[model samples]
Target chain A: MNLSGETKLFLGVIIGTIAIIVLAAVIMSKPTPPAPAYTRNQLIPIGANTKGNASASAFLVEFSDFQCPSCKAFSSVVESLTEKYKDKLFFAYRHFPLDQHPFSRTAAAAAEAAGKQGKFFEAGTYFFANQTNFSDEFFAKAASVLALDATLYEKDRNSNDTKKKIDDDRFFSDTARLPGTPTFFLNGKQLILYDSSELVKAVDEAVK
Target chain B: MKEKFLNDQMTNRILFILSLLGVAIALYVTQSFLRKTPIVCLNSGCELVRKNPASYIAGIPVPAFGLIGYTLLVLLTFLRTTSTKLHKTLLPWIAGITGGGVLFVSWFTYTEAFVIGGFCTWCVISAGNMITMFSLSLYSHSHKK
Candidate 1:
């Protein structure tokens, strides 16, 4: 019953190749799932941090945390898209500070405070650009750089209004069942962010 | 004496084949992750399960780790089949690796079923391969010496 070593190696290769081919065929035969139906709802709120035309047909909402590295990475992309589609897209940012980041809430409040002075997008950009610096001094410096009223910025940063705005956004995110930071919603439908190109494609589809 | 030799060769052949299959599965999954392509699936749940943040560890995709594991197993199997001295030396390590792989498969299966509430067809197949490989490796080891 002894077999030559060459025979064993050849048999092993054959068996392995057949197994691989079968596996590939099985995977290829799988049916692709239909596109998921996203529920349309009113995700916008009054005084939300927004850019672009309010009446644009394509509405893009971002649920992001300032202290989240991924969120910071996505900020520039979001900004570029907003500018590119300024005439046809409306972009909004909502706070979703994760509990794991100790400075996330403070950053969210800082952005909201800047929003009070009609500089939400600018403040947000600053927070994302300097994510490693999250101290109060840094926030104040951002306000100064933006030429916001120093005294008003400090007061508004700690105001009940700023806290409420952030809290409300968190509540909405929870209700929508968002899994993580940097989640995007297009026209009230969630867009899975596997890649930035996916976001662009979704936006193009929405625009069409 | 010839029957025993033939059986051992057959066992090694089976192990090599299974290890190859494992590498193929790992490679396919890793490719999907790297390309950011949706995993092909007969079930609607593959997307849901794969999109979860838990699908990755410390920014590296879980399948990438799987690919490494399978590659190591393939190397070990190849060495075992080619050299008697290395075969004896690597047999225990192979057994431990396959055993760990089975346990990991079990944990991930439970996580996908209960925690994620979705399943990837590829993942399930890979887990099946791991279980078979574990069982066969144990059987071969037990019958050795």
Candidate 2:
């Protein structure tokens, strides 16, 4: 076939366009290793449930859902992260209850309620451990171990303030376009965790 | 063939370039979305638009449609520039395809702004790209020989 130079050039452009797009996509989509910890602790919102150092420049924030199994697995990692980095790193947890999990919203409220009584992480453990059995009954049993006043626990969990707090966190997740629960932000940078250990790596980098 | 197409091939050239740009932006958004990597937005809107149930139509990411639309526009514009015989025939196809592209952007932009309450900057760029290409095509179609 006798093709003009114009036709050949057009074909070249098309091929080049496709090739460039594919190349760029491959590069951008590569799972980013934990971003070098560039901590912006100010991004940690006021009133967020937090642990570890209050004034530390290095911090980690997580938006998690209690009924999520991956979140359950991750909570332990965060638990140890807080302990290991105590007096050095700050950690904050925010609710991002996905609708697919029936008990996610309730569990988030329960966590908030626990936060009021200085048992946020403890309540989180109970919810994550008893993920399958989430309900008022299970929460009441969990609250029993927290040594919280039963009446206050019940009242606090059901209070409007607790509901509003979860709603605010939910709104932030929606606004941030958080991909899903168990999403972590090291300092202010989002971590692309291909492995659970990335959290530790990220915190280590942040503190350094 | 119009003297305009022969002498002033500016729209054809520009449309091709704009459509190519659209392809790149749409490709990035589609892949970022598929990989579940958060797009860094000018504001927080990208996440809201991306993660919304509305972002997927029949399990297909919305930007995938933009990618297809832009790619088609690219091909048609390229064919028009290369083949004088096919030039007239390709103009209407370019216009029609871009018209559809505009409509697609309109729906998503509306949903993003009103329903989802946010919009991605890339989506905005794509919307402008389609609208500009469509306008240029309209000019090319109506410009007198």
Candidate 3:
């Protein structure tokens, strides 16, 4: 076949497209590398509600809302995962109350209030269990059920400090441009969970 | 006969360019859908479509199909330009490919309008591109003889 200038040019573009696509596929398919240490705490800042050893090399931070169905679904798994890696994992839960979930903000505040009383995770048990049943007085009932100080729970849950903490989590969520609820970061790398079991596998890997 | 050859060359060039444009549009849509990023569209239609389950088929983002189709067209158009023999062989394949593309895009457009109850600007632009390429395919087919 006799070669033409335009033909070569178009073929060049076609070849270029294929080359770029192959390069991209190769890059995207490789496992994500660990994030640098300095940027690690940017998402898991000080005073954030946390469990496990602060200095542990494996850190897991979750941006979640109590009223989110997916978050609730993953709550039990995370709880058990944390228990399994209690010594090795440093876990933090940030609140990202989507506007669609009307009670999520209040539930976040309630969780923080329980944090103040040192029963945040315990309160979480109730919150995740009764997501669909949240009412204005649900927080109070949960506090009562957990045997927390009723007066302090009411005062703290309604306090400006609790509001600020939840607001700060929201601010961080927006700053990170988090895609959706229950977004998890394991060892400073976001975990894309296709199934709940991925969490256990990832945490096991992280701790190891 | 020389004039006719030039016309076919011009038509193939036009098809190649259009296919290139389709690639760009499809690439953007595919990336946006995969990354869950909001797309540039009028009246938030892009976000609506992005969130809708219909934007995917069998868990594969819809724009991926467009990307493959357009990229294949790009290759075919360039091959047709190499020689008259190749053009004769490739022109009917181009027509068939674009004909299938038009049908698929039309179905997607209909799903967007009626089933999804919204429109993505990229999807609409892709539909237009597919239709135009199909029209060019028919034009070249008629002129082939």
State each model's CA lDDT, in order: 0.77, 0.79, 0.82
Cα deviation of B139, candidate 2, in Å: 0.5
lDDT tens digits by residue: candidate 1, A122-206: 8888888888778877876877898899899899999998899899989987886676767888987777667565787888888
Model 3 chain B — which ten-residue stretch has the worst lDDT?
A: B36-45
List model 3 lDDT by residue over A1-208, tens digit each.
6788888888787788778777876775577554333256687877788998888899898998888766776788899988888899988898899776789998998888888888888888889898868989787687878888889999999999889888888997787766677778887777666446778898998798
Q: What's the lDDT for residue B61 in model 3?
A: 88
lDDT of 1 by residue, B33-122 (tens): 765555656543455455656677797777777777777787787777656787777877778888888888888888887766566788
- Model 1's alpha-carbon lDDT is 0.77
Each model's TM-score, in the order given? 0.57, 0.54, 0.53
Mark the regions of model 2 whose C-alpha exceeds 4 Å error after superposition: A25-208, B1-8
Query: DockQ for each candidate?
Result: 0.07, 0.09, 0.15
Indicate which candidate wins on TM-score: 1
Ranking by DockQ: 3, 2, 1
lDDT tens digits, residue span B1-145, model 3: 4245437778888899899889988987887778655566643456557666787899898999999999899989998878779988999898998999999999999998877666788888889989998988888787777
Write model 2 residue lDDT over A29-146, tens digit each, in one string: 5775554443453346678898899888778899889887557657788998899888999888988888767788888887787888898988898787887687767777767778
The chain B TM-scores of all candidates, as shown, are 0.90, 0.92, 0.93
lDDT ranking, high to low:
3, 2, 1
Runs of candidate 1 exceeding 4 Å displacement: A1-41, B1-62, B65-68, B74-145
Considering only N, C-alpha and C atoms within 3 Å, which residue pairs clash in candidate 2?
A177-B47
